[model samples]
Target: MYLTVFYALSFCACWRKMYFYKLNMAVRIMTETLIRNHLSHFEVAIAGCGGLGSNAAVALARSGIGKLFMVDFDRVELSNLNRQYFFYDQIGQYKAHALADNIHRIDKSIGLRTSIVKLDETSVTQLFATVDLVIEAFDQAAEKQMLLETMLVNFPEKPLIMGNGMAGFGKFELIKQQQWDKQVYICGDFTNEISEDNPPLAPRVGIVANMQANLALDLILKMRK
Candidate 1:
């Protein structure tokens, strides 16, 4: 595995390949240029690749985080035109698939993978074991809960970073999902109390998405040191 040539992981290659990630030399050079020293050693997975998830993907890839696995079920739509960077040509493409392709196009050097499947408690829990950490960026509360519940129960040790209160002018928080311990980080308006309920969405989403990327980068930095 090329990761063996660079990153050493608890999990090894799923299969052997001719060229790692199918990336060319130019991609390898550019990918390494933007990656920080601390992030060069590890991989981080993003489980939701919609508004927040998609933006976070760009941030992480630009920063040169080694690998990413984006997961989403829905196709891009006219509604996603506002904030997402995908093209009008990609209207029918799944968010996860689009993000994966975008990330690869952004930096083929990074080992990027994706699953275009709606996440269930079953698949997510099973998938969590293969990752170092998960960035949770679901648009729906129920889907968010599905990922959170599974990670909290079965992969408690894996860091689960999530966004909260990123809509209706609420604040943003990148919280660590823990079973027995709960710590919240708020970036916008947590005062409404109603923010604790309902779905999140906009500038707040932007705020939270950047924060989540920073949090993931921060964790990767700490792990490297």
Candidate 2:
């Protein structure tokens, strides 16, 4: 009974501040003890670091996820300047590397790994073994489909989250997710409606990405019965 009371206090005080290298061994130990199945041991992978993916990564980082693995091969263009706040003067660099640096810079204690390669059959297999969750941020249908199919077949047990539909014709779903037998959660743009335009708008992307982030965290929390 006394141990339980002490455990409660450990989290309230020191654990909240532990993200940015702020915790000592005692606090980390006690806090980890209090939490259940924390994301500390598992790494979440975000594929496609464009606007939607970028925003989702930031939200997840702030949500106290212990480790993140971001993958993107494209470099920032002047066009990407509008939505990707995660992109800065560090233009021309690969998106994965730039975003990874930004995340680690924002919270030095957060474990962020990166892969600057386009998602493909070979790479998908290579990366899935290292990931506990997958977030699909690719804009193209083909890429999204490939990413989904690969993860489903290879790492069927890993939770996969994806985002689409942030623009054009106007079907805004505040949140949409799923748990396939393999634990796939498609976060945004589940509509069959195509607006002749892809990559939705800034607001739509942000909303869906936010939902994706929430869904990812919920999956991690496993609070849903």
Candidate 3:
């Protein structure tokens, strides 16, 4: 009887030890997988800190992007609060500066940098030269064309992702991604535009911006491989 009791206690101890050992191994594996899958080494430049830019910046910062370069000349307006990420108190503040603060609030570890300056044809290349990826989030068609042209001419080697045509309701399926050319990817419906009658809303704009952020993250991960 004494021998049987001793053996039973020994088996219980061994089982508990093995169970903990496996749990620790699983935890270590999960940690390593997360580290390996992180895109924390890449820097992205987001031009135009309006709806698309600000939303995408928040997504990327949360996804573990190491650095961000946000550029925008516009100030946050009360109307912009409908789609943009700024708070009510941030009205009249530069979008770039406000966006950087907002992003830091989401992920304080992110290296948030802001340029409260206009990005024209001449300045586009210099502003985005150091970033690993570029996201064009301007609302105006003319500005989008200008930035697209500038990127193709100066930084043709880098990837330029832009969003367009995300302005209405019930057209969720239309909001998709397309590769315009080598090093150029466009996200949105490719048809709709915001106007006096059709104002920019949050849900659709957020969907498109999130898509751009996801695509950018995927591209960064692919580059790593």
Candidate 4:
């Protein structure tokens, strides 16, 4: 009789576990469906396809962004393999085109427009004018400043996300997100500038990049609601 009772209890426990697992899976599926349905209509432009831009673009693509306009004129180099998301075989390819191809492998349905031209103030305004949002992934301080000014001045209505000071190790807590105004959002430590000694590392760069992607998703979803 004791054996029969133990068997029955064990069966009940297993059944309960299976039931909850199925319930969690159902909820996850529903959430993903909702996100894809909503995000399939929105478009974003990522300026500069280096470490920050490459990582952020992949995150956004996986999140189901409908389209992406990638702009970068630089070619991938062996040194870029340390931080950026590019294979060694793709070293000679333009960053924008290579990134687009990689994003396609992840989600073929995602629309990609690649421009292998350097970005200036006029080009920045022209390329990003129609996109729902713009991401500033430039490495240089001057480029970051240029993009920020152009976006705020030329396209105040659209949202702009940027990464500022993600370099070197430790102090992960220093990485933060700040809203400069109603339209501009910045992410990073805001202190560790990339230089010869303090180079951009994968961990810190990826953190800032994913933060930008997360902010982009949040802003898009909120706007949809």
In order, the Cα lDDT scores of the candidates are 0.68, 0.74, 0.88, 0.92
Q: Where is the poorest 10-residue window by lDDT in model 1?
A: 177-186
For candidate 1, write residues 157-178 as lDDT tens digits.
Answer: 6777776545545333433322
Q: After superposition, how far is residue 154 of candidate 1 from its true place, in Å?
A: 0.9
What are the RMSD figures for all models against the true structure?
Answer: 13.6, 8.9, 6.6, 6.6
Better candidate by lDDT, 1 or 2 = 2
lDDT of 3 by residue, 1-225 (tens): 999999999999999999988996765433534643566778999998999999999988877888999999899999999999999999999999999888888888888888888789878877788889999999899999999999999998889899989987777878889999899999999988898877889999999899999889878866752
TM per candidate? 0.71, 0.75, 0.83, 0.86
- Residue by residue across 50-162, what tens digits does model 2's lDDT show? 88788899888876777888888899777776677455587788888888888887778888888888889889999868677788888778998898888788888778887
Maximum-lDDT candidate: 4
Q: What lDDT would candidate 2 get against the real structure?
A: 0.74
The per-residue C-alpha lDDT of model 4 at residue 190 equals: 91
- Indicate which candidate wins on TM-score: 4
lDDT of 1: 0.68
Q: Please identify model 3 stretches exceeding 4 Å from their true place.
A: 1-37
Tell me the RMSD of model 2 versus the true structure: 8.9
Minimal lDDT window, size 10, model 4: 24-33
Candidate 2 local Cα displacement, residue 1, angstroms: 29
**Which model, 3 or 4, shows the larger lDDT?**
4
Q: Number of clashing pairs, model 3?
A: 0
| Candidate ordering by TM-score (highest first) | 4, 3, 2, 1
